[model samples]
Target: MVEFAMLVIVGGALVAMVMIYLRGRSGFRVANPESGTLYVTGVSPRPDATGAQYVTITGNLTGPSVPGTVVYGRMAWDVNDWPAIGDLIPVVYPSGKPERWQLSRPGARPGLGS
Candidate 1:
């Protein structure tokens, strides 16, 4: 009985792990990264579930699409790393899909007053 119980517990754990992995992968499925512009809109006053801040951005994407298609996106950042309002930041997103984007320069911080 004890062995059977342990086996069931292990199997349940494995199934849970697989489900979590699949969900994460599908939730963040972006591809064909291309350069786009980010117009800082505002920063959230409260932190997210992970205790990270979120910056809101809205702008027209420069990818292959019907021009003038604006995208509104929010990116998580450290509390002290939020961008200033009206700032223009270069970002990369999947071609024709600027909603899912990230900073073009790896590890680059925004709004340094430069």
Candidate 2:
């Protein structure tokens, strides 16, 4: 009986976590996402005092709407999957906010700088 109750509690927690993740994903779709060439000009030194590594990928947009706008975003520790300098990637943003561009892998991209 106790095992069943514990399973229910764990299941509920997992479900809640999925819901929260989905909710945040909804924001990524709140506005139309634009694609652009990611120009990685720099990357900051990682593993700060908190021992947390962060990668700041910088680039710009070239679509009709946020054309050539300087944009940047950060991601968690040692993302070996991140693109190289002068690589084309997808850039997304909230509605009417070009400066809030985010770098994301479109569909099922596997190769770096592909």
Candidate 3:
């Protein structure tokens, strides 16, 4: 009877392990990836261990369709790459969502900055 109980416990543990492994194997999810233009309203940099600046940028969009949707996001980069206030920066937003955006230069890669 004890051997039967031990066998059942071992079998249940093996099944649980397989289920957990399969769950974690699910792949990466993609973002909405909509691109647009927005103005930089402000920037504040916080120093990191690598000496790179982690900047929090607030975008002020003043367009006809997207009227005044201010969004704040952070990016890690060299100080030279930081955008100035009132500068019209290339912004990528989530599909059907303007408030979720990332600021970037023209011809640069999208969805890298957060």
Candidate 4:
């Protein structure tokens, strides 16, 4: 009975690890210049952080114009220069009021200059 229990525990752990790996590897990139929509991978912030989180976006390029290319962009969570990770916030452009962009849990790919 002890051996069987140990085997089951080990197997469960292995399965859990595999699931996590797959989740991390399942992300892809999608971009559309016409609509100005860019889907990035690895943009999710780490758990536990304050304001203005920084995340690195990476993956293959998609959309009408850009295809099979790699790009990067910087997304600022808050107005502060240093934002913490895992902070679900909107990115405020320099345009004007009510002009803001919110990054999804797993943010989009980093665009140019990121």
Estimate the TM-score of every prediction: 0.54, 0.51, 0.51, 0.31
Ranking by lDDT: 1, 3, 2, 4
For every candidate, C-alpha RMSD to the true structure in Å: 5.9, 7.4, 7.5, 13.2
48: Cα error in model 4, Å: 2.2
lDDT at position 44, candidate 2: 59
lDDT tens digits, residues 37-93, model 1? 666555455444444566665665554452545667676666655566666677777
lDDT of 2 by residue, 52-107 (tens): 35667666556545557677777654444434666666656655576776655543
- Candidate 4 residues 1-114, lDDT tens each? 999999999999999999888976854223321222334444545536666665554433333443434444554443333233222232222122111223334343323423
**lDDT measured at residue 103 in model 2 versus the true structure, 0 to 100:** 52
Model 3: ten consecutive residues of lowest lDDT = 105-114
Q: Which candidate is the best by lDDT?
A: 1
Q: Give the Cα-based TM-score of candidate 1 against the true structure.
A: 0.54
Q: Which scores higher on lDDT, 1 or 3?
A: 1
**Winner by TM-score:** 1
Better of 1 and 4 by lDDT: 1
Give me the displacement of residue 16 in model 3, in angstroms. Answer: 16
What are the clashing pairs of model 1?
none
